[model samples]
Target: MMATTHALAGVALAVLVGVLFPESAAGTSLLPVAAAALGGLFPDFDLYAGHRRTLHFPVYFSVAAAVAVAVAVAVPTVTTVAAALFLVAAGLHSAMDALGGGLELKPWLGTSDRAVYSHYHRRWIRPRRWIRYDGAPEDLLAAGAFALPALYVLDGTARTVVLGALGISAGYVLLRKPMVEVTQAVVDALPDEHLDRLPARFVEDFR
Candidate 1:
């Protein structure tokens, strides 16, 4: 899924948490929403290094999130609620990767088997391809689906953020395939030395 999609999913989860626990700090402040959105984007930060393998701990994050949720429920401070939402969002992002296309230059081609890394299992999980690929039309739909409740419930800055994400998601869906082509063109024109420094996926298929 697109980063926006993941962020929206996190926001949706936070909103759900707020609805379920109206008296909690999560319902009163945007901190937990922000935390969850950031957490959703956190795992993708490893995109340059190991991609899915570096920080996408599907099992471990889920376990930690479970514990964190328990702690938050027991005390329900702003800090605990934010922390719990963060872990839960991160875990959700990691696990949700399995439902998308694989990690490759052209994931829509269905060529790669690896969707996300599972350190606990010491292997890669295969892509389910339910959404085909990030930035696909279906991905935009998924983003919209997650954004609905958030847009309905949130106001001020949070609502603006969701709108911005929706716009970005729409633009990305249009450019996703073209961006890959442009990257390939740029990579093809680069010198061998520079190409060597680029990520393997960028050069491997072009070479």
Candidate 2:
């Protein structure tokens, strides 16, 4: 899914957590929501390195999040709640990747088998293609689904952020395929030396 989608999912999770524990910091402040959103975006930071494998620890994150949640529930504070939500959001992002398309220049083509890496399993998980690909029309829908409740519940800066995310998601859906084509064109024109310095995925299919 798009980073915005993942972040929105995290926001939705935070909203749920707030609803379930109205007395918790998650309900009282935007800090937990911010933490969750950042966590959702954290795994994707490995995009330039190992992509899904570098930081996308589906199993390990889930385990750590389980423990973190227990700790937070035992003593809920801004720090504890934020930390727990962060881990949970990161874990959710990692696991959710399995339900999307694979790590490919054109994931909508469904050509790659690798969706996410599971270090615990010592292997890659196959793509489920539940949403076709990041920035797919369906992906926008998913983002919207996750955003609606958040928009309804959040106010001030958090609400603005969600609106901004929705706009970005829409623009990305329109440009996703075209961006790949543009990347391919640039890759094709670049010298081999320059191409060699670029990320492998940028030139793998084009080369």
Candidate 3:
């Protein structure tokens, strides 16, 4: 799944939880909702360091949830909202990654990545090649399905959750190839000496 998909899932899960348990849902304030939606992107932060191995770990969210719950014991209203948002974001992110065959789940923990993915791999029971990162019809369809509720259910800053999802999907579809070409062109134009100084991943991917 792509970042847009993860973000859309975050918003959809938040709203679904809100509808399912109205009493426990976040308030009209956008902070809680925003927190959860943004958390969707948190796991990907590891791209700067270890990709899907550091920030992508489920334990990080568990700790955040635990802290939120503890805080809720004292400040029920605000903390409850934060907790719900965080859970939806982290939970959905992990689930999507696992299903997409992109999750390793052993960041900072002494766990086996192969073991984790192998267990999750059983859920699909098909070849791994079928799982694409983006540009699949299913990605578009899923984005549309999730966006409908987000666009109509919340307004102002809240609406941005779904709106941003839609925008990201559209942008990716419209720009990914062109951007890749542009990046490749730039890399091609650069001298070999400069390329040698670039990050190994960048050089390998574009060269």
Any runs in candidate 1 off by more than 4 Å, and if so which? none
Residues 9-64 of candidate 1: C-alpha lDDT, one tens digit per residue: 99999999898888888799899999999889899999889999999999999999
Q: Worst lDDT window (10 residues) for model 1? A: 198-207
**Lowest-sum lDDT 10-residue window in model 3:** 106-115
**Per-model TM values vs. the true structure:** 0.98, 0.98, 0.72
Q: lDDT per residue, candidate 3, 1-207, as tens digits? A: 566777776776667655665666353455666667777767776665745545565545655666765676566575576665776587557545654433222111222222112222333222132334354556667777876766767887767647777877877767655676787788889999898776565675666
Counting clashing residue pairs in each candidate, in order, gives 0, 0, 0
Q: Per-residue alpha-carbon lDDT of model 2 for 41-123, expressed as tens digits?
A: 99999989999999999999999999999999898899899999999999999999999999998998899999999999999
> In candidate 3, residue 202 scores what lDDT?
63
Taken over the whole model, the C-alpha lDDT of each candidate is: 0.93, 0.93, 0.59
Colliding pairs, model 1: none
Model 1 residue 21 CA deviation (Å) reads: 1.3
As a TM-score, model 2 comes out at: 0.98
Better of 1 and 3 by lDDT: 1
* Global lDDT of model 3: 0.59
The better-scoring model by TM-score among 2 and 3 is 2
